[model samples]
Every structure is written in structure tokens, then in C-alpha cells.
Target: MTETARPAYKRVLLKISGEALMGDQGYGLHPPTVQRIAKEIKIVQAMGVEICMVIGGGNIFRGLAGSAQGMERTTADYMGMLATVMNALAMQSALEGVGVFTRVISAIRMDEVAEPYIRRRAVRHLEKGRVCIFAAGTGNPYFTTDTAATLRASEMSCQAIFMGKNGVDGVYDKDPKTNPDAKRYDAVSFDEVLRKNLRVMDASAIALARDNKLPIIVFSLDEPGGFRGILSGQGTYTTVSG
Candidate 1:
């Protein structure tokens, strides 16, 4: 039998929201959600694509939301980072349970629980076909995981960053949920995203991608098997390129 073809991208950075791990509960880690994400990543790994994931903590703790409610900004941000760490561990357990080799690397030092963030070591892990889950956002305050995703993607030299949004298939001219007249874009330039003020990702994240010439693929994570399909270029998604 002929060998199956590998994915086009040799390395990729997947950015998932904490809510994606919540399933139907709308809060906290849901077992089935984590397992499904793990399965998708496993499929990409099998296709020879080195995967590094940066999962958000929005479901557990959104720093901005807390700050809006009268909490200290830095403290809230740190809590958000910790929330991401928890999500990362949950994902790690799910991935390892299926016999997929993985590592959890945290920006903040948590030696007993995970490896501290080391750029070289992260790249090494990917080269060895081990999935690396990056937790903690830039290890500091005033930054979102979206920025961290771009930073990690640039550092890891990933060919593209896969943005797994909860709903809505891709970036649209307007909020599809709010406007029926919203137009979906198949492909777009980073400049246009900024010009149009699209919220596919934060401005900082989009700027970084533009500067480094990294493409961002926006797709709905809720779609069954969509992640694997995107890597194979068979999914409904928007490609933002330089």
C-alpha cells in the first residue's frame, strides 16, 4: 500500500480557548472536550507536523473581565496565567492518556509540575515529534494569549498559527452572530484585518504575524474533525497572510 501524504505544514502553533475545553457546561474543564482536542492534535502529529499549543484561560479567568469588576489588574492577569496553566495540564493529561508523547512548558517556573519555558528546548521537543503545550501568557501582565501564540509561533518558527475559535467559521467583515449581512472572507491580508479592525485576534497579535510573515488560519473548533481537515487544506476557514 502507498504511504499517506503528510500535511503541508511541517510545524504549527495551535491556539485554543479555555472555553473549548468546557463542552456544554459553559465553565471549567469538560473531559470529553479535552479528549476531542487531544485526538485532533494526535492526527496532526501523525501527519509529521510538529505541534505546539497555547490554550487561553478565558473560561476560567479572563483578566480584563476581572479588572472591569474592580480587581487589581496585575493580580488578575497573574490569576489568568495560572488558569492557563491548569488548562494546559488538563490537556496534557488527556493527550498522554492516548499514548501521545507531550510536554507542558510554563512561562512561570513550576519545576515540580512542568518544564520552565526554554525556547531551544521547546524547538527540540517539536523536532523530536513531541507536542509542546505552552502555558502562561508571556509570563507577565498586560498581554493576552493571542500575543503569546504569535510570540511562540515566531520563536518556534512554525509555518502557521491555527486559531480555533468557538463559533463562526472564519473572520468576517462583521460579527456573523450579530449581523446577517456579514461577509465571510476566505483569504485576507494582515493589513486589511487591521484596517477593518477585525477581531480575529488582538491588534498586537495581528501586527506580530504581519511583521514575521506568519499566516493565521481561523476556523471553528466546534466543527467535528475540522482541525485535521484544516491541516489537510480541506476545511472551511479563513487564511490571513502577509
Candidate 2:
């Protein structure tokens, strides 16, 4: 799409899982994968879209998984939050390497590592064409990064949240990986998503987005130019809204 073709939304929050940065590796950040996604963000940003990002830390450590392994719940969660900060730093480096101004803002107070998340400051970054990467998952235990994305999206007054999945293209009636005949919904209501218990996002995240009337666009990060194409209204994605 050309620069003359205006995007569907002005400002958007992108929520990508840390696993998306892992590439074929079982764990840790893959430089090439992070660079690829960072380039994608750069493309969209070039179109004058103010961007906010919240990356999950599942590739490093999952709070629930750590807790399941007998670790203390709060400690596991704090570790998970730290993992997100690492991912955010990696992403910041990649984005900067690609000439995109980016900031890693953490919900937790870690001045040595990342700038503490301040709502107005974050908004100012976006207004200045700097991509704001929110880290640390709300700085609290038991809250998923999904919820953080929703909360930040709302606070930033983003038009929608773009959720980039690794392999899955969009939300489905069943597990497409396991079911041969799963159907993908082009558009779905937030209430329906919660009522059916679909995995588009966790229940808390979905409910938060629902209550605030924020739309989520789920698309495939595996697709080349998929994020940009979706914003340009030329890609297949699932829209979850009221």
C-alpha cells in the first residue's frame, strides 16, 4: 500500500507473545526473528501509525508454568515480569537497529534497565513517533501480559489492539491445530468470545477489552507483511469487538 492510502486506524497497540521472538528455537530470543518483527513495526510506523507494544514472556518464563513446577506463585510471577523486560530490551535494540525510535517502559520501577511506565510520557512518545514497548505486565502478580496490553491500549486511547499470533491466523471455533475442520471467524463479538471460551485471549483480558469497548484484531505474524496488510485493510484477520 502507498503512503497516500490512509490506514484504518491511527494509533494501535500490538501484543506479540515472547514465543514469537523464539523462531525455531525452543527458547530465548532469535535475533533474526526479532529483527523481522521489528521491520514489520517499522513499516507500519512509516505509515504514520502511532504504536504501543506489549510482549509476553512465555519464551523465557511463564508465571503459571513456574508455579506449576512448585515455585512460589508471586515469585514466579515477578520472574515472569522480569522476563518481559528482557524481551522488551531485545525488541528495543532491534527496533533501534532498524532506525525506528523505540522506548522500553516497564510497569515496575527499574530505572537502571527501563524507563518506568508513565501514561502521559508514554503517550508523548507515541505522539513523537516513538514506539512505546510496555514491559513487566502491570507490575503485579497473577496478571497476564494480555491484560497489560488491554489496559495500556485503553490508557493510550488506541483505536484497537493488534494481536500477532505465531502460527494461528485468527480466532477459530475450535483448536485449528488439532481439528481438521475448524472455522475461523472474520468478526466476532467480545461477549461471544468470552461465552464460548475461545482462546483469542485469556478471560480477564477479553473481559477488560469488552468492558472498555476496545477492538482486537488477531492476525498471523508468520505471514509476510501481514501486520501492515491488516492495517491497510488487505489482509485476513479476526476482529473481536462489541
TM per candidate: 0.97, 0.99
Candidate 1 runs further than 4 Å off: 1-3
Candidate 1: the clashing residue pairs are none
The residue-level lDDT of candidate 1 at 158 comes to 95
Highest lDDT against the true fold, candidate: 2
**Model 1 lDDT-worst window of ten:** 1-10
Report how far off residue 122 is in candidate 1 (Å).
Answer: 0.8
Highest TM-score, which number?
Answer: 2
Whole-model lDDT for model 2 versus the true structure? 0.95
Candidate 2 versus truth, CA RMSD in Å, comes to: 0.7
Q: 90 in model 1: Cα distance from truth in Å?
A: 0.2
